[model samples]
Target: MDLHEPVTPFAVLDADKVATNVARLRGRLAGTGVPLRLHVKTAKSVEVALMAFDGTPGPIAVSTLAEAEAFAAAGFTDIVYAVGIAPDKLTRVADLRERGVDLVVLLDSVAQASAAAKAAVPALIEIDSDGHRAGLAPDDPAVLEIAGILPEVRGVLTHAGRSYYAYTPEEKHRVAADEVAHAVRVAERLRAAGYAAPVVSIGSTPSGHTPVELTGVTEARIGNFVFLDLVMAGLGVCAVEDLALSVVATVIGHQRDKGWILTDGGWMATSQDRSTAQQKIDQGYGLVTDLDGVPYPDLLMSAASQEHGVLSVRPGSAAELPDLPVGARVRILPNHACATAAQHDRYHVIGTGSRTVRAVWPRVRGW
Candidate 1:
């Protein structure tokens, strides 16, 4: 049996396209006077992380300690864990730092800062730009308080998560501007308090991809650009053709009567991230395409269960599955690249049906 025809569903990433995405993102950030701290959560693989930092100096952002450890092991020293670090994980951060790894963690609360200050690990103040998750307000008094108390605090970080809701270029640019304003406010507050808040980090693929005015932001951390998904396409961050990663699954059953194509790869393979569908166009689960990554004219994987994906067909497409056999392989672009990437342990690299066993990027599970 051919290796590419293996039983298990595989996640494939195109090296060539990923390089192009990285180059495009770098070009967009040019003349913005800010360094790009590429996020590693989207591409869990160290190989992909290297590709992200290719030709550029280190300085990458990660979401998990495991990613920090993995990248640190691979000789990447500068890593800012974007997620809020719990009080208990301080030891791990210290350990990585003790080993010469510049592992900068995020602190949102005074208590977290107090705990972090005792650990001797460098840290950043997670300032809220769009309030997608945990972080202090840009002008919140706690920003200065935490900056003062946490002597290890190095800088401030902000994510304009609202860009995910953006539909037009203007909306994305506005979110980017908001992020820059917020980060600048917090950084200035920290500086006024005698803290050397050097790094004013801002992010969001949509906002970063647009013509963002990063006059004050010292760095930007973005991830999804490495593997633009359906969500990025829907938000106009990138075209569908720019999507570099996809889930390759075999068609198991045909719903000729109901017009559904069942696949082994389902919600378990893709994720339950419906953030993209909230836009004008509901992409359902994702855009379903053929083996060559071409979306079928009228077919989309609208719904999915734990182990099965249901395909929604157009009004008159009974002849669409004429050549689709029981075991034909298909590619599925995920709704959210970050969430879907966290669901897999390995990425199966494929090229023209010839498969090469690369490396299984073990994910960091749990909170």
Candidate 2:
């Protein structure tokens, strides 16, 4: 069926673009002395992750155990549940281990570590690369103390989430260096303890694009580079031309009085994530664009309610062009690829036409 015919808003992942992104990242990480452990959290789909790996054995990282189990069953053996695992998840972790999958969990505290140790699987220490959220300081004895736990420690991993907060290329590059530094320091601590510490992973799409001095990192798990978004564009990670995925929305109304083009795509289709973390600039929802992925460069969606998105131009430009008629098809570049992908059940595989040639469903919401 023609993907655009459906009134329902859907996401599309271009097969050709996916392949291109994989190649681009592979070339960037060449000789970095670390394997790319593609984080599935951002991609979410087993199909998308498989495409990202492009016929390579991966130490796949997931945000949920359900994603881990789904990918594991699909023959992905080396999996790391990047999010913290609670006591209740131990049973699922044990089950995955029984299947011969090298399942790893994340822990930040001694109590969490002690709890995870009971699951009989090694746990990777999560380092707060930018201190945006949960993770222990790399030099904190707590990391070493957690690693010292026999058989339960699996070394360390970190996400330069702060890169998401960076407003300039220089700032993003700085955060990338800091990400590598955090990993190096923690890895050094691990060596001092006489542990092999095989997994010193670090990444963030924006930070990964810049030159990362991976001195002691053994793995880099990055996602979102697979589907560049407006936020990435704003941070100067990649230009809008590099964006591989977008939401196809049909213009259902035109408010010339207010200079708005109402599309079927709304907060439900795009997601509620503002992604604007008190930064110098905030992409309210996303950039307005043509069906072919051309950002109206001048147009932006400034406000949105559950099922409605309002479009606008900067104060002075609104009067230049006034109308986007009803029934017109358009695409929206999301601010956050991961959250945007989660709102839909499947990606309508777009190839040479407007029709959906196939459906790629991403694993959603669970352990």
lDDT for every model? 0.79, 0.77
User: Model 2 Cα displacement at 341 (Å)?
Assistant: 1.0
Check candidate 2 and list the clashing pairs. Answer: 65-367
lDDT comparing candidate 1 with the true structure: 0.79
Off by over 4 Å in 1: 1-3, 55-57, 314-323, 351-367
**Model 1 per-residue lDDT tens digits across residues 118-141:** 996678999888878778888788
Task: State the lDDT of candidate 2 residue by residue for 1-367, as single tens digits.
Answer: 6665655677877767777788888788885756788888877777777777766557788888888888887889998888877868888898989989989888888877777777677888889877798898877878877776647557788888888778776887799899888877887788788887777888788777887577777888888888877777778777767777778887778778777778778898889877743444566787777765666756777777878877777455644543577777777778888888888877777753345546655555655
- Report the C-alpha displacement of residue 36, candidate 2, in angstroms: 0.6
Candidate 2: give its CA RMSD in angstroms: 2.3
The alpha-carbon lDDT assigned to residue 180 of candidate 1 equals 90
